[model samples]
Target: MNRRDNAPGASADIGAALYGLATRAARRLPRDMSLTSAATLATLDRTGPRRITDLAAVEGITQPAMTTLVRVMEKSGLVERRGDASDKRVTLVCLTEAGASYVRTRRQAGVHAFERLISELTGDEVEALVAALPALKHLADLESQDREGQNQ
Candidate 1:
């Protein structure tokens, strides 16, 4: 019998466990900005500049909501709107130096937090996590591809 078939609720259990870990980890981060705002900055950092509509779609928010977010981020000097070189009518939101710095700092903080947490695990337990890294990364890649497909 397939192992998956043998475990009817294994997937759900794993999802719940992962969600719990994520929730707890997120709480360790600074709450200066909304999750959406941080996500927006991360997107810009990864994909360079993007239109507000694209950002909204990627973040699963409305264009108007993204426009408002852009406004706020712009005011905070984390992002700036610029005319698209190829399409002057379209505006792209780009991350400022400060925004990139914030992303880096936040990422480092998260890494440090996880490092401390991981250090508490037994050697075998840590090995289990290390073994699971590929699968976890693949899951993330799948989700990213799904989001990209939806936007397209």
Candidate 2:
């Protein structure tokens, strides 16, 4: 039997469709930026400076792995490390201006790509997608809450 036959609600169908679209969209993105690097940059840009441990947690990576990733990003001029003023023992990682600009450029490129694809969709399909976005966001929030609960 088809999996959709076992699924309930338009939400499930929409979610699966969106997931497929996102997978294809990610494949279409420029090869210059890795998804992890883009995610790190976007997180830093949105949240400002963070300790390496915190960054690792946000990125869902091991501390040592995050350390290595940060070092690689540092070498590429995307991030900089500075001493935390209040906690002299702790170091804060932040995006350089170049990193922020790079993230913005990549985001714009992704948006443009999506917009082009969206433009091809019928008006009713676009309306359906727009209507689904709020529920999708809520689902994401629910999943995050579930993770947090599990962690605690």
Candidate 3:
């Protein structure tokens, strides 16, 4: 058996290594867009329209901070707000067509960055990365669900 299999802190070590690899690839991408903006757009794309409060919670930021981000995105013509039909007091933020296109652009850049990294890896490593994608997505979904449950 590998020494890691018997180590008490092996899981954390592995997690850190994987996180480092992802961070490295992310760092290679252009810094034209802030991470917060990309994350906000990505969240809206994944979850559809959401109230400002909900978006703040999902993004793990203060409601006021999210409001500021929304204002900036609105000014950039990437998002728009409308009063909730069921609750006039609440406002929902939705991505504009431009915003969706921006997300696609940002996603493609990240994909290209990772693809470059993949080119440096062996065939077996690339296969392992592909196999791990589903599990990574599941982990992400579960973590978000857990946070939402806590917020409620």
Candidates' C-alpha lDDT:
0.94, 0.85, 0.87
Which pairs of residues have clashing backbones in candidate 1? Answer: none
Tens-digit lDDT track for model 3 on 1-73? 8866788897798789879987887777668677787889988988788998888888888999999999999
The 10-residue segment of model 1 with minimum total lDDT is 1-10
* Candidate 1 Cα errors over 4 Å, as ranges: 1-3
TM-score of candidate 2 versus the correct structure, residues matched by position: 0.80
Task: Residues 24-129, candidate 2: write the lDDT tens digits.
Answer: 9888878886787778888899779998887777778888988998999999999999999998999999999899999899889998988898999999999988
lDDT of 1 by residue, 1-152 (tens): 87779889998999999999999988878999998999899989988999999999999999999999999999999999999999889989999999999999999999999899999999999999999999999988998899889998
Top-TM-score candidate index: 1
Number of clashes in model 1?
A: 0
Backbone clashes under 3 angstroms, per model:
0, 0, 0
How well does candidate 2 score on lDDT at residue 33? 67
The worst-scoring run of ten residues by lDDT in candidate 2 lies at 143-152
Task: Give the higher-lDDT candidate: 1 or 3.
Answer: 1
**lDDT at 136 for candidate 3?**
84
Instruction: Return whichever of 2 and 3 wins on TM-score.
Output: 3
Q: Which stretches of candidate 2 lie over 4 Å from their true place?
A: 1-11, 136-152
